[model samples]
Target: MLESFSNININLKFTIENEKNNSISFLDITIKSQNNCFQAGIYRKPTSTDNIVPHDSCHPQVHKTAAIRYFANRTVTYPLDVISKEKEQKWSEGLIQTTNTIGNLLKPKHNNKNDPYKQSGVYQLICPKCDMIYTGQTGRTLNERLKEHFNDFKHIYRKSKYSTQLLGNKHPIGQINEIMDVVYVGNKGSHLNTMEKFYIYKETTKGNQINDKNTVPTNKLFDVVILQ
Candidate 1:
């Protein structure tokens, strides 16, 4: 069986043992990959396709609540808290995790208009008219960085020495206000600088990006996928 599989560039995994009747039995086979693993069960005997069939009674019967509770108990890294529904009598093992450790049930939720950029990540700002793009990343939240961009526009208006080249007369005026769209690329925290450099390199190669060119160092590696 191993030789047969090898002929087709397929690897077969199993163990064979001699039986009392001068026969061989194949044990279970295991296969592994980067993110997952699989195991094949042993067959009692070699049989033709016509004689082989799946047993209907061989299915596992796992209770949903019991399974949830079992995993919840094992995976409770932080303090575990359960919230029963209002006026509820049934014991619900299904959990709703919260950052709050204080037993406050009525904590008011804040609904900010710009809540999407509350995460630390790499992002892109695109111009509507010329399709020019600016690739950036933030150690803090994206909203904070975006606010800085808006402040740069204000500096441009006041003719500050620190005026942004992103909105100069050479480029599109009021380009910040005419932003076509914003994109959230990835959440690489400390590695934001490297990731941002990677994106800037890629965008500049396309000849439509507004970012000033700089020599990217080849010393670091990042798991970046640029789909053009």
Candidate 2:
């Protein structure tokens, strides 16, 4: 003869409130039967309350309340059935272990090699209000670009009268604003030249008009040329 047999069914539903001032609530219903007798249980977690409590009940039950504030707004449901106490305990332990393993696996891992500033295919903005002119190159280091600019200035000054006259006796034509050096990795050819020209024009214009905030002077005597 069979000693005992049990059947259990569990249903869970929950609501979440993301607002700081609001709350969320949920209801859980459980039904169990052994031999000929049946038992029903109801659980409720109210928004104002910090603990969940089980209530005795029979037949179908309905539980309702405000939402919880401290927990993430999510709901999970599972069914439970058992024929013996040992089986029930084993099933519960297995569920807990599975949930913990999944949670750990989903967590983000950190690595030192990741560079947040390294970007490709885009233009970077430099500060036009700064004291120095920042010259930069794509696909290369800012220091490298600065070195190339100085080399070019030196070579051209000896070969061309225009470069000698413009550069004059200045040892370094412009100081490198290290803080404002931007690498535009995506811009190509004419677009890159235009961007460089724009930066130069803006910085020169702002420097010349540092004292005036009103309309630009009508006289063409301005130090910087405005390229339309």
lDDT of 1 at 125: 76
Candidate 2, residues 74-114, lDDT tens digits: the string is 22222433333344444434433342321222222223353
Among residues 3 or more apart in sequence or in different chains, the pairs in candidate 1 whose N, CA or C atoms overlap within 3 Å are none
- TM-score of every model? 0.38, 0.24
Q: Which 10 consecutive positions of candidate 1 have the poorest summed lDDT? A: 83-92
Best lDDT among the predictions, by candidate number: 1
Error of 2 at 187 (Å): 3.5
Q: Candidate 2: how many backbone clashes?
A: 5
User: In angstroms, how far off is 30's CA in candidate 1?
Assistant: 19
> What tens digits encode model 1's per-residue C-alpha lDDT throughout 199-228?
666666677666665545432222233431
Error of 2 at 58 (Å): 68
RMSD in Å for model 2: 21.5
